[model samples]
Target: MRILGLVFAGTSTPDRSQMADFLGDTLGLPRVEVGGVEADLFELPDGSTFAVASPGGMGAPRSVGFLVDDLDAAAADLREAGVEVGPIGENERERYLHFRAPDRELYELTERKAGIA
Candidate 1:
């Protein structure tokens, strides 16, 4: 089966409010709620959709996954912003780093390999 997109980043309502600020104020993504869950409904220019969910310990949401053009550069930028970035994991198609926000939800950043297309 083919996957079109993903919804990630599960947190409590209060924490989700803070995350919404970071995503909206810091990252500049529009905030939206779906099915009663508040989210930073991220829409990339390439038409990719990613979501952050505020669940009251009910839904089974996965960790947030972000696609970056450069893994090292992105990690460095996040580090400069004082974000805690984890070690990167590499595969044939991409490299990824995991990081935790103040709300403690994990987020992943991925860099697809060169010439993937």
Candidate 2:
């Protein structure tokens, strides 16, 4: 499985509103609204995303997503190698899955929907 780039990074906090404010107001990242999820989504200049949300929103306290060209093949390869992979997650714009690393940290593999940059 070949990774193309870094797609996203997110962290959870108990104070979601304050963190959201800090990210948008202080950092000046462009805030976006994502339906069906309770989080403040910010789009970086490079088109990657950063999210700040309440604890438990993403199933991990902190996580990063790597862009992949083939989500299914990546998942298969990781599973064959005995990696602890979570279920596939889909939204309007992407498909993704979380996996546990050897160090027990959770990370994600993401495939952007066709026509999306």
Candidate 3:
């Protein structure tokens, strides 16, 4: 399993511009706001993206996003392995399913959009 990115979600009013500035100045990350909400795409110095969004926007807090080659196959494998997986949802341009691990941590398996790598 590979982790593509981490999503930090909160209910507070998000400030995209401020976030962009902070990320660029402090963390030296490049940011791009893809939508009207507080959802922003952050390009880490290592070339990976860490997306931040309002709680009501992208996902819940502490949500772990996994990058999978095939969503259906991954989901099937998880189910066959006796994991309880949730239904898949359509995101901005991808399909993803959420599940809880034995420790109660939320995990997400996703088929990202083409060219995201």
Candidate 4:
């Protein structure tokens, strides 16, 4: 599977343009827009896109969310591959299933709705 982006848990939703400018001017990185979400798509000279978003609000930083292409298929594949799947929260809009990597980092597979911008 292709990694669309890397989600970071930030304290607040910082000014998108300002952040983009800082990355472009100071860090010399390229920015890209994904579904109206402004992100420093190329930072650290690496190909990974950095997706910054505030979790729950200003002070509730939680987990990183990965936007996946196929929610159900990914979740099923994980389960069939012998991974433990977490409960799916329907009201959360996106379909999610969580699993822990060998390093104990919590990884979530999420399939977001299209045109959610």
Candidate 5:
């Protein structure tokens, strides 16, 4: 399982609206829509995604996701290493799985589609 890059980082705040203003207006990161919701997605020039959500929007307050060359192999390797993995999540561009790390934080491994970076 070869790790590629840090593809995503997200944090859930009780005041997402305020955070959104800072991210979009102050930082100048372009906002993208997620499932019809505005002001959550921000893409860096390098293609890494930073997201801010309401506390209830996700299961965890913070998440970090890495890019993996092979999702299935990584999942198998994680299981063999005794990691607790959650279900795989898929979108049009990528597939990802969440897992609990030794620190008890939830991290993600994503396999992007062929045409997507």
Candidate 6:
């Protein structure tokens, strides 16, 4: 399946309060929560979204995320092609997975949870 678009730049920060200030108070991006993850998400003029999520790691470089049509199918395809794929994580409203590229860049793929609007 084709990627829908770049979804987010996720970072692993020990604490997000200051990061929140930087992203919201400084950068002026609105903060919102989706599927239990608190993040700053806003739509660009071109209709693409920019999001930032907090993690437990400190001062790490951000990771890239993408909106995919089908998380399960895509993982299966990647596994079949001998790629190192992560297990899909699901919550009540979201399904996502993380994996590394040939160059070792971090990436995450996500989709709306089944039965979710």
Number of the top-ranking candidate, with TM-score as the measure: 2
Tell me the lDDT of candidate 2. 0.91
Clashing pairs in 3: none
Name the regions of candidate 4 deviating beyond 4 angstroms: 7-62, 91-93
lDDT at residue 76 of model 6 (Cα atoms): 87
Write candidate 5's Cα lDDT for 8-114 as tens digits: 99989988989988998999999865453322889899998888988856568998999999999999999999998888878767798999999998899999878
What are the RMSDs of all candidates, in order?
Answer: 11.1, 1.0, 4.0, 6.8, 1.9, 3.4
In the range 1-117, model 1's lDDT, one tens digit per residue, is 122243233444546667767777898766544333245565545544445556743233456666676778889888998998899876564576788879887777766668752
Cα lDDT tens digits for candidate 4, 1-117: 344565333223556557656667887766555444322344344333444444333222334556677777777777888777787643223455667666666666666667542
User: How far is 114's C-alpha from truth in model 6 (Å)?
Assistant: 5.9
- Backbone clashes for every candidate come to 0, 0, 0, 0, 0, 0
When 3 and 4 are scored with lDDT, the better candidate is 3
Put down candidate 3 lDDT per residue, 9-86, tens digits, no spaces.
Answer: 222235646765677788877765543334666756554456655544554554666777788888988898889999
Best by lDDT: 2
Model 1 spans > 4 angstroms off = 1-61
Question: What order do you get sorting by lDDT, best first?
Answer: 2, 5, 6, 3, 1, 4
Q: Cα lDDT of model 4 overall?
A: 0.53
What are the runs in model 3 whose C-alpha is more than 4 Å off? 1-21, 35-38, 45-47, 56-59
- Candidate 3 overall lDDT versus native: 0.64
Judge candidate 1 at residue 113 and give its lDDT: 65
lDDT of 4 at 82: 77
- Sort all candidates by TM-score, best to worst: 2, 5, 6, 3, 1, 4
Candidate closer to the true structure by lDDT (higher is better), 2 or 5: 2
TM-score of 6: 0.74
User: For model 2, how does the per-residue alpha-carbon lDDT over 22-54 read when each residue is reduced to its tens digit?
Assistant: 889999999977665567899999989999878
Give the Cα error of residue 38 in candidate 5, in Å: 9.0
Q: Give the per-residue lDDT of model 6 (tens digit) for 8-115.
A: 566656566677678778877766555555555554554344555567331235677787889888898778888898778775556888888798877878786567
In Å, residue 9's CA in model 4 sits off its true spot by: 3.3
